[model samples]
Target: MQAKAFDTHLFKRILKYTKPYKKRYYGVVMFAILLSVFAALRPYLLKQTVDDYIAPKDEHGLLLYISMMGIVLLLETLSQFYFVYWANWLGQDIIKDIRTKLFQHILSFRMKYFDHAPVGQLVTRSVSDIEQIARIFSQGLFMIISDILKMLVVLIFMFYMNWRLTWIVILAMPVLVYITRIFQRKMQVAFEEVRNQVANMNTFVQERVTGMKIVQLFNREAIEYEKFKDINQKHNKAWIKTILYNSIFFPIADIISSLTLGAVILYGGFHILDGDKFTTFGDLFSYTMFIGMLFNPLRQIADKFNEMQMGMIAANRVFDILDSDKDVQKDGTVIASHLKGNIRFENVVFSYNDKENVLKGINLKVNEGETIAIVGATGAGKSTIINLLNRFYEINSGAIYIDEQNINEFQMESLRQQIAIVLQDVFLFADTIHNNITLNNPNISREAVIEAAKKIGVHKFIKTLPGGYDYDVKERGVMLSSGQRQLIAFLRAYVNNPSILILDEATSSIDSYSEELIQKATEKITKNRTSIIIAHRLATIVNANKIIVMDKGQIVEEGTHQELLKREQGYYKNLYDSQFALES
Candidate 1:
């Protein structure tokens, strides 16, 4: 599906979005054909007024011809308005549908996809590239079709009036067509560059903006700005290429058109002077209008072709995402209705890149309602265990089971619903605390949220904030403290009352006061609930009935705190002594 050619496959797929708006699509096509007919008829009426009505001084017939021409003009004007309106209307609606589906598709992708795909690039495809796709309908495809239809109608009239003059115009068309084909290929390539640069620029800006605090902390503003300028320059260069092609092609087209029209006029005059009876004043006048109609559309076709080319390029990028096979596999049919919290991983081997295993071959188990703590160095695969249990990323080998039922057999949604996690870096939407807590789930009422908040002792902390439950967290909860964000995340998890709870370094990076609040919240949530705590802070997980120590993607030790301390040369003992020695 090279954009240089017709791209029939890509074009048809793009138009498939209009399936729901079939009536509007038909109306636009009908209007385009009607407008073309009405357009050609105007010149014919002008020729009639001059030759039949005004020539012999018949005032009544001239007035009737004038009325008919005016009516055709009015009808053409109305049809053009509706034609443009409908096309644009269809474009906006189609893009709306595409953006929504793109978003949903993105959400359904496996966690591994996000690991490599830049947030900025995805945003560009969803927002900017999708906008360009709209131009296909609004300014590209149908507009080009209408222009082609008008040119066809004009050529028919020109030949009917005087074939000799029509031949003059047709002779110049091949050169114009040759130049147009060349221009289309150039602009298609240029616009493809433009789209790529836009995605790069978007990715840079989005990352820089999101990480502004880090940028300032690292004092890299000047470096980042220089990098942006480089990307921006490339974006500007791409647009200039398209502009250069347009500037060269259009005027050449115009000159060719003018010369052809001039040839028609000269030929018509010479014939009249030589007393050719067929070349009448009416024929000359009608031919002049016909040439205008013909050449003008030819010029617009080149302009509209660029728009369509850019649209095709954009549509190609969007379809890449829509057609992706990277989505999470959801083939299971079993509904995981209240899980009993039993979890086991047997000979599980997993890797994000498949080049190096993040979790090596291992076997582990936790009985229903048991509490276990996993302590490991950074990159020791502590978080990988929780991720596998949640099915955020499917394991590469062996299998995981919940209550002895293979996790793969359980429907993804229902299985996930039974698990709740509070991450170290909690992400809160720029919305009210209440909405963030319940995640706007209609089934979870504000009353239930407040009750859950009360149960976890976070109720008073939230009420202390201005507007309390209605307080806006702002993007990623920037308006709230790190502790406050974690507290909200806790409420979010507790409101769902998930059967399995995992706390992934939830207490490491917060103030002592917030840690106390979180500790209390954790105790309430984990009471008789299956809990797995992954933490670097040995103090936080010492009370667990069992503690597993990991080293280089494998579990090296397993025991309670007292039992682990008894091992003088164990991995857990060394890690614990080193961690607490620094604190002391």
Candidate 2:
């Protein structure tokens, strides 16, 4: 574990979230103070009752003193309840705001950020890490303050009662503080390791569970189990280390507490044996109870300190994400509505991680209402072009224009509103088919979704299902077949009625019947819309007005299908001949 400096900035930022609930926070503080004052008064009242009433045989005075003691206890109990209630309430409200802000920040990041980030790590940050922050308020920070205040009041009353006995107890203070500092430093490293191990385990579990089908299909279940066992073991070790530190520190604190009590009894007993007029049995008894009160909070302070450290660690992890600059730059002020869908790429260069260019000086143009097909071998920059067009990744150089205006000049939301894409690997949420289609957009009504399904020729198939549009797709649409999922995706895209539609190998993996239905849908949807089709199946795009053949990230030929076939040694011709021979 690495050493981290105390982050004053992070602490102040967390304090800012409490501004909204300051009234509740101040209520908790007040209750804590009252509870401490009442707690300190308990032992003083006992001493007074013993010396002034019980020793003199004053029954009426004893009864009155007992009644006052009972009232103090009741006030102490009521304040304790308010302290606990308001502290927890304040913690919950603060974490709710923090979680919402963290989620919104995550939603603002670009595709590149998510592409490299593990899903489970992000989940742990959003869920478990934020919970640790809540503990800081409820269990760590407020409790520590309350204990410190109680200790201070106890010390003040003890010294006033008997300064000599107070000095004996105070002699052990330096030793206890030194031991606690060492424990805190060691536990800080242990807690960090525990948090990291938790994140690793979450990542491993999430990935394995999501890919369980692959693990079973390839007979790698035993191998994956072994891997999981290793990660789980590491997680266990991290936790055990923290527990070991706690085990060592707590008993030492208890031993010191007992020794302090023993020292007080021996010193005060000698004074009584010597016939000191000021030392009374009630005073000695009260010192014993006060000693217990003093050491008990010291022990609790160690535990609460650990909690505070854990909260600080969690806050650092969360702040790292909140402070990141990986979000897509959405600075354009122009709001494009009802775009004409004319697109052009000029000398565009791009790379996923900037290591090597995936798209190199690519240039192309598609007029409004034109259907263009991009054909290429794998990794030949076909899909990269589509990604750049959607602004999923910013181009390294060059400019892209839509309707003779720079695409970067348009507001991202307004620009994306006019464009729709049906990806190669269709993703369907664990939701109803209707909600998945409309994506819960209030502007898209149920009737419009049904009409769009009808226009795409999938309405009959959807109606044939058990619940029609209301059917739950289950996780990743596992309840539906691959072809069925693709049909649902097509219906989802069609309902949006986007001016520019992109189909990236959308019909590659389905059965012939589904492919034929999708082809019909594609023809109907692309009739008056600018569509970009990237497909390996040459037959599917034979009617495209223009076909661009690419190899090694550069365009080798551009023409109609029949015209490309006439070339003696063209990339598209060879690709077409090879696939045609295999089909025959």
Candidate 3:
């Protein structure tokens, strides 16, 4: 019922990802072919020894034949060993390559893509999906080739011994193929359901763990447990159906194989007694052994058919992500030679989706070495403006220029490197304070990190902890207070020393005393750079060089603090009055 994910176009495209491993893949194929040939040789040699040497008591012939068979088997074992070892290595490397590319591709997508997609589903597509593909490549693909080769070799030898006897044995071939096709179709449906249920279970676990504190506070443990149990039960039921189909397939194939063996024995025995045959006792004995060898591989191929189909579906999903176009792509072969920190937005129109506009024909400009404040009601597109400037999303129409050159003309990485943003919501990795501050910048020294921390007023507080800069902030920096986290976020932004800075309510979470400290540090940080602050508290930005008032995605007013305050009939006056009333 879910739209078919098994797109042939996507499958062929994904095969291109294997181009780098051609040598290893060829090695696996050669080894499988050799192993199959050697495996088929063993029964034929045994039959010759049993029918001729053992019956006539020819000691020399028996020893020579047994020794040759032993050597063949030893070589086969060695071949299998390398096949498994190198095949595993190759499969892992391919998955690693695919996952690395997939991860980078997802990161390159526009912010709206992440906003609309689930984090857990992305994680599953990256990890679980790739793993499924690897299993098919390593086990399913290699085994299939080997089994088919071995089956063909056995069938050839069986017919060579006696064509009439071989036909008697293979009369069941049509039925075997028919039954395997049915099982393939049935198990494909059931196994696909199993895979979907597993992904759902994964999503459930991720969500519950992320919100565990909220669940505990509300005392909804039992309810959450019941929900998880229901999901788990669905997964269990899907798996049961898969097992049931698989279990029925092998037995049915086995019954048919047994019937073939019985027919061979009865028919071949009659020919031997009548002396009206194209086969001898030894030939019939060897032929039946060859027929027996075909069963295991045939049955295995039937089983792995299900794995192949599931893997194809997963590969299609993964490649779909990898093949997605970058909507916020860079352009031109030019790089910005100089950035003077000046920024201008020219009649920009933008939206996450085109159906509705988040920012409608907004125009504004900021000079180098100036501080501009943006104040507005919630959902008034303040942060959306920041998102546009940073090129997290492309404008629907109109151009934004930096120092007179359109920002889109410069390479994306180079443009972003010159800018830094400190948001109201701070996120810290579960790592040490030093790593969090430097953020793995190889060129950033410890002294530089500490200086940035001191400038932002987090140095003294960090040193008071027992581990100092080595202190670990677990899980989004939950170990620190809101103000402390804000200070760290500021230091992170300041450590980069960008030419342009965007501070979106950087001091909104701190108390008055800490806010005063932050205000001093902020003023020092923004002195000679372009600063755009989305101020939550109007007082913080009252001293800004310019203040822009926005309403419903339009900039209705723009001027210095004194100029805007003196204006008649503006949104700035009402905002200032309401905040003053609330504080008083």
Runs with alpha carbons beyond 4 Å of true place in candidate 3? 1-11, 217-223, 273-288, 326-328
Instruction: Indicate the TM-score of model 2.
Output: 0.97
* Candidate with better lDDT, 2 vs 3: 2
What C-alpha RMSD separates each model from the true structure? 1.5, 1.4, 2.3
Which window of 10 residues has the lowest lDDT sum in candidate 3? 1-10
Candidate 1 local Cα displacement, residue 219, angstroms? 1.0
Judged by whole-model lDDT over C-alpha atoms, candidate 2 comes out at 0.89
Clash pairs detected, candidate 2: none
| Model 1 segments more than 4 A misplaced | 1-4
Task: Give the per-residue lDDT digits (tens) of candidate 3, residues 1-584.
Answer: 23243456655665666689898888988998888888888888887887789878999999999999999999889888878876777778878998998988887887888877677778888999898887766776787888898888888777666789778767778888898888887877887787788778888899889889899999999999999999999999999998898789888988988888888888878877898647567766686677778887787787776666777767766876776786435544556545788889999999888688989998899999899999999988999999988788889899999898888777777777788898898889999888988889898999999988877677898999769999999988989888888888888888988888899988888877678777888888988888999987998998889999998899989998888878766789878888899999
Per-prediction TM-score, please? 0.97, 0.97, 0.94
Model 1 per-residue lDDT tens digits across residues 1-584: 34545688899888899999999999999999999999999999999899898888899999999999999999999999999999999999999999999888888888888888899989889988899999999999899989999998888888888888788888898888888888877877887888888899989999999999999999999999899999999999999998899899888988988898789889989998999988878888887888888888888887788888888888888888888875656647899889889989899999988589988987899989888999989999999999889888888899999999999898888988899999999999999999999999999999999898888888999999999999998999999989889989988999998999999999988889889988888888898999999999999999997999998899999999999999999999998999899999
Spell out the clash pairs found in candidate 1. Answer: none
Model 2 spans > 4 angstroms off: 1-5
Taking all chains together, the TM-score of candidate 1 against the true structure is 0.97
